[model samples]
Target: MSGAVPLNDPRFQTDPVELYRELRRDHGAVAPILLDGDIPAWLVIGYRELHQVTGDPALYSRDSVLWNQWDNVPDDWPLLPMIGRGETSIIHTTNGQHRERAAMISDALEAVDPFTLRQHAERLADELIDSFCADGRTDIIGRYTMLLPVRVLARLLGFTDEQGPGLVTALNEMLDGGEDALTGHGHLVEAATALLTEKADGPGADVVSRMLANRGDFTVEEITKDLLMIMVAGHQPTADWIGNTLRLMLTDDRFAASLSGGRHSVGEAMTEVLWEDTPTQNVPGRWATRDTNLGNRRIRAGDLLILGVAAANFDPQIRTDSSVLTGGNTAFFSFGHGEHRCPFPAQEIAEVIARTGIEVLLDRLPDIDLAVPGEALAQRPSPWLRGLTSLPVIFSPAPALSPARRP
Candidate 1:
């Protein structure tokens, strides 16, 4: 493991694409990697190799209990929130159980009216912009992009408006993969369980109630854990999607037209971001069920394989010209692949929230521009997700619109 690349290296924050290229050049499709505490694993950066791994869940399982390094992992491991052990959530479940849980989640999300979802996003976006628009300048990340998705998701999931801020803080800490991860995860669990308890007697038309009403025979504890998983999975990536796409539009010349009432370009910019700067960069990941050979590397039973999603999207074999626009191409692994990929309804919900949020912001502030040099923008240091820590911007001062005003 001496030559294994450290997944938590500081350089990954600044130039992950270059690092991924280096990993591919040195280690081919599957590179040996060390996570926090120098824990050994494999980074699958090849597009085809990643597809094979995700497509064959029987060989590469989502159950973290099968990981070989758990014996050496300390009790306070920061990644425990991300790589949970023995959790009953759909992310860890496989085969029939996973299918049933996935179906339940899809059903609950599918029940959401798309128009209502967009209205929530637009209103929330307006409110967020109102707080900072008159100032002519704002850190869009803190004030807008980071706040929108979770708030919208909270309302949809039956949580009150007062609960949204706390949920945001907890999710950020937990997904950050830092010292506060466990504490944040604990808060999330407590919140989910409390909400489930409250909704037990007075079920509403929200996601939790629908989940409770499902005939899956899942226990309350199981449902609670699944809710936590759904919230975590839904919020951060969608938030990043908005932030990353915004960054692309404000800084890249190709997307400059989007700022000038070119609404058609917005979708193109988003698709391009998914291929290049995807929110969920590296998923920590499937475990080897038995000894196997993949991408010319030897593997043993219980070996951990981190899915290099962004890396796979940029694999030179598949993307011969990374500079070209992606347009409607969505063959990327941003939402993942195979049966464990993000549920279709969940993806659609994320799209509605992200697309609506961006469109509203652009419609309201047509001249918004980056407030700082593009090179000055920094991404969060976590290896799991790629998102701007803050997107400072300056725009023409505008009056806050009334609730009756329509964009």
Candidate 2:
């Protein structure tokens, strides 16, 4: 309710982090911003506010009911049905049906033993390292880090390597809000259609097929969308975290040296990376279902509520000091909090990404260093996510390690 921030303002587009910092300082925890050409919404930054919103389903609804409030907005806007649909999966769905569906999915994901995941994660690490070892110079984002999780998820979902490219491309396009902002759903729909109709064959086990056989409570359509969501959400954030963590390690040499010293050190290093650079920078959105009090202010029924997970993660009150978060800590809001928290599978996946990912990179390319100055790197400009379009790094000791022999 203070100085209004137009989403088009250069600050909104360029430096969202700094913008959030200022908003937190000046506008209190909850501030409103108009994004997508004046679609009114509130941005919530204070940890207390986000916790309150995420914890209460009755007061603050994630259901698509919020979309109906935006009657002036076009029918085709991407977020419309999403809000109306409400928590479709465990992430945001609030309705009992969606919760049941999520429970089923959770049961399925939980069925996969932790030891099995560890073994698979080890194999995945080996394969990714193999690809990058030959040249010792590869784009970790595109070539290795990103590919591994997709491979694992595909195998889990019963997808193929051949399907990887299209699925990955579709996911990127769908998420980037590119090529189909109006519909914001073509890529996922296409992939889901193909996947849903495909025959189950081949020597590998498929998560989708498993779900098909024992889809506790999800409809075929819901199952497919949930699978797609899992695939997209599972990998990209982990890849970004891996990349960001690597950059952090290279940025602070002493930290890297300490991390490389031993196995336990790797855990510490992962914690540091998480704290320093959370993979997903955007907080999920929520809407006020009725008039409510948030941090001493009156929130109307129709007002948009923004959860600034990034800002909350950096809040001085929760953290010991802002300076320490610079290295990567698990305490960050890159994931989320409360009842609307991310799925258990996603958390396990992140653990795999952090642990196995860091081990592989260090074991294989121990001498890898940032090729450019940290300040010179270009970060992507989306308030919903934080990542580099491309990160250029150079491996020292020349020829680097061979693929077969890489750690």
Candidate 3:
């Protein structure tokens, strides 16, 4: 549990939730660490502590990156940066700026409404599953889970299917740190350029096109970057949630039975999966801007901070019982917390994935099971992310067992 593991190791490549559980049990909430000769920081793993840190912007700041502000200003900082001395986007902005941007974004999302999107989500879900139902088996991560959100996000942003593959690839590359030139907001800059140059008007009702049509409120630059932010933030978490939920069901049919039982069970199952295996395992890294108390620790300026959403979701202290993570309990850290919480678009997307997508998948596929035993499935290696790189499931078209005994 202590030694460094290769990123591509089978253990790391499969069962990310188990790895997170192992790490939390071994490391605790405020674990000490030294990484690559850099300043050591505490990785907060408990649910209560992670919630506290994320909610309080006064002590911990999300803008941890040290921009080069020598004689010349860093290219990253904006002319009228919203927070602190240098300008940054809402995600990295702290306190007031973060709240203001969140309000704007939330208002936009609310205006879209869940009732309207459900029909579209259902249609998309139908198309995606129809292609694979005949195969009798598939990798949920690659074919099913990853594909739909990108499409939904593209549709929401006004991008065409023609542009979906490239945009998704670019976003993943950015997340994996493959291209140094696109670090931080530079990634957003690159994505926006691609959309503007190629898909700006080709043909689609993506979020980008919507923003362009509603140009009165946002600047071209702001529209471009915010769309990029949605692309980057929206797809992965939803994709991972869908994929991980399938993984959970394949491993335990009881959970699947419960989900398939009715509408209420579907919502309960989604919450349970989030608590058991949250899609976003690691919170964005925060830095202490000034000396402050987090729980009992004395955190000082420049000290790196990590809120372990995965760990916190499973915290026995808050959960009161571990099984609650996989089956019960209502409150959770699935979408994150407070100022740095995930955009509320997350709730609708999650509900869609849970009730519509997952329920239908389970109903259509019978006797489905993991290709590898649950223990053998691989996990993504990063401590900051929780997801399966691949989930191979065997599927068959058959009616579920009697409803009375199911679940």
Candidate 4:
């Protein structure tokens, strides 16, 4: 089971849906798999069963401090950034702690008026398009999908453009669990500390400022962790969502002909990406609170569970035919469930960001087309996420914008 079931298995990585079906047939919905270092855990693939895991904090906990295996696990575990660190952040906490932090985070993020943030996103999108518009070619991932989010997130958090690159790079390495994970994480810690110091001068209009304004209750350390958690939740995942959404537009004949051509609207297309090809296909390291039965499997306390959002989204019992569409269903577990649902709902954040960003590209580069066959694209290496490492595209050249008009 360990050998065949690790998601890193070449066969499973190449075409996960096929293997998910096979696993369901053999092991039912809750299948066992191996993480890095051969650590064993359950991979919950059924929609119903996953809801049981993600929604019930009483039975399946999120706080890593509660992990029964905490002492045994090494500090350098690669998946640490994915779920273990930032224990005090809303995403990492449970019960009352999560509620308190959630309110704090919501108040801070609300400073970013949705309309203004969307406009800023479009302006950044246009400026990025201008940079490569004359060349007629660009790697969509590097230039558009990835870069735009870092800029927008930086702006929303009151960080300067100069600070964006370093912050983005560090967060990317941390999430990818790359060879430089420790270095990347350390850089993030430094960046967060510096940003906190800068905000200390006085709270301004950005999320960081608002978080710092709560000095009466919030600690500088907590605010720093809150900022880091926002980066973890929004930075790379948003970029990956944009890439996955556009990948469909460039490949699927329906969307390729016209992004609005299919029955799925831009919102729905974005949702589809979140469901069928979630940027993070397998959410790692959700620990069991105690001996619990998920489906027919008895999971021991502290055993990590990989919520197979990608697998559960396609569970045959809930989804009869996903060949055509995904998302909008209450059953879709893409954004997660219960207290951990993305800070904003599907239409609220990911869809709005991706749809608005895509609209900007479609309007500015109307003639854009995929540079390579979809099958020719290479994926980033990870046991979890399924993302195009790069996406090359070509379009009719356009003139650069005047600095007067550029954001």
Highest lDDT scorer: 1
Deviation (Å) of 283 in candidate 2:
3.0
Predict model 2's lDDT versus the native: 0.64
* Candidate 4 lDDT by residue in tens digits, 1-407: 54337656765456778988989998998998876666677899888998888878877887777565566567888766665653666666778777777777776766567888787887888888888989999999987887888888888888888888888778778777667777788898788888889888866788888877754466787777878877767777788888888888788865665543432455666777777778867886578878878789888887778888888888988878878665465457767788877766323655557777787787778778889888897767666677778999998898887867754
Query: Cα RMSDs of all predictions?
Result: 1.0, 3.4, 6.6, 2.4
lDDT of 3 by residue, 259-303 (tens): 445434556556767887777665546777777777566766766
Best of the two (1, 2) by lDDT: 1
Ranking by lDDT: 1, 4, 2, 3
> Which regions of candidate 2 are displaced past 4 Å?
6-17, 75-92, 180-184, 199-204, 258-260, 325-331, 396-407
Q: How accurate locally, in lDDT, is each candidate?
A: 0.91, 0.64, 0.61, 0.76
> How far out, in Å, is residue 353 in model 4?
2.7
lDDT per residue as tens, model 2, 144-235: 66666766677666666677766666655555543353243566566665776783333235556666667665666677677766776776
Least well predicted 10-residue stretch by lDDT in candidate 2: 78-87
* Candidate 4 Cα outliers beyond 4 Å, as residue runs: 1-4, 10-13, 259-264, 327-330, 345-347, 404-407
> How should the candidates be ordered by TM-score, best one leading?
1, 4, 2, 3
* lDDT, residue 334, model 3: 75
- Candidate 4, lDDT over the whole model: 0.76
